[model samples]
Target: MAGILIIAHAPLATALRECIAHIYGGCPARIGALDVLPDSDPVEVVAQATAEIERLREDNGALVLTDMFGATPSNIAARLATVPQVRVLAGVNLPMLVRAVCYRTTSLDMLVEKALAGASKGIQAIGPGTPAPEYGCSPTPCAEAAADAAEQAAAGATDNVKAASGLSAGVLKPAGAT
Candidate 1:
């Protein structure tokens, strides 16, 4: 499995890790997160990130996820691009991180593809007629089923939830699921 590192501004990195832990019942192995504080030293942060990457990287190398392009975190992450087998992706989000974690066991190149795809697909504009409590109504069963069907159709015609979520068969389970 490739190592996965999340580098972002203060609190976001740690929070994303915590959220993953919640989703998967626990944070999976070969994962590390570093929060870059406003007052942090760039040199020291780079050293720390390199160490973490070395420690976490396995046969598949590592994937570094950062917040924004041209920011401190991305700049720090960019430094790792020269490292053999490492890829840096900016604009980290929950869906992107989840997809990366789910697909970490794949080849490094495949993992990058999955992460970028997840980042794009996770974004959606909720418009009128979508059943959401925020919109003040539950979706009818038919509407929900249609939505599920459409989503599955969009997921490369895969019916398996795990496949759609970028997980291998029988690999991961949410917290408290049997």
Candidate 2:
């Protein structure tokens, strides 16, 4: 399993980890974070981040998630990328982190793909909307419609039901079915 290292502006990294723990009951092992203060020395911060990345990766490689590109955190992540077995991604979000942690058993490239997919799918411009009401429609039609919407929320969903609903397709399956 590849370790996860979150490098972001101060508090964002910690807050994201906290959010993950709150949602998942607990944060998984080998997941670490470094909150980069705006006023902090970039050189010193990079040094600290390097050590954290090394510690988290251990013998395995690491997936580095940063809050934004061109930021200090991302800059450090870029520097760390030169090191062996370290991959960096910008625009880190809660969904991305959750998916990364869940699929840590996968290969580094696969995990990156999953993370990007998760992050992109998680974003949605949700607004007030009501489920279509059909006077002659039965309950089954509504259920089927929801399932269809999930599957077709966005074209080319390879990793599963990563829709605006935020639920995985696996959740709809019966135990031992897969």
Using TM-score, give the best candidate's number.
1
What local lDDT does model 1 show for residue 141? 25
Give the alpha carbon lDDT tens digit for every residue of 1-178 in model 2: 6788999999999998887667555666688889998798989988988898878884447999999999888998899988888889999998788767655544577678878877886677646784433855323211332354456656655443343223242122212212
**CA lDDT, every model vs. true structure:** 0.78, 0.71
Off by over 4 Å in 2: 58-60, 130-178
TM-score of structure candidate 1: 0.77
What would the TM-scores of all predictions be? 0.77, 0.72
Candidate 1, lDDT over the whole model: 0.78
* lDDT score at residue 2, model 1, on the 0-100 scale: 81
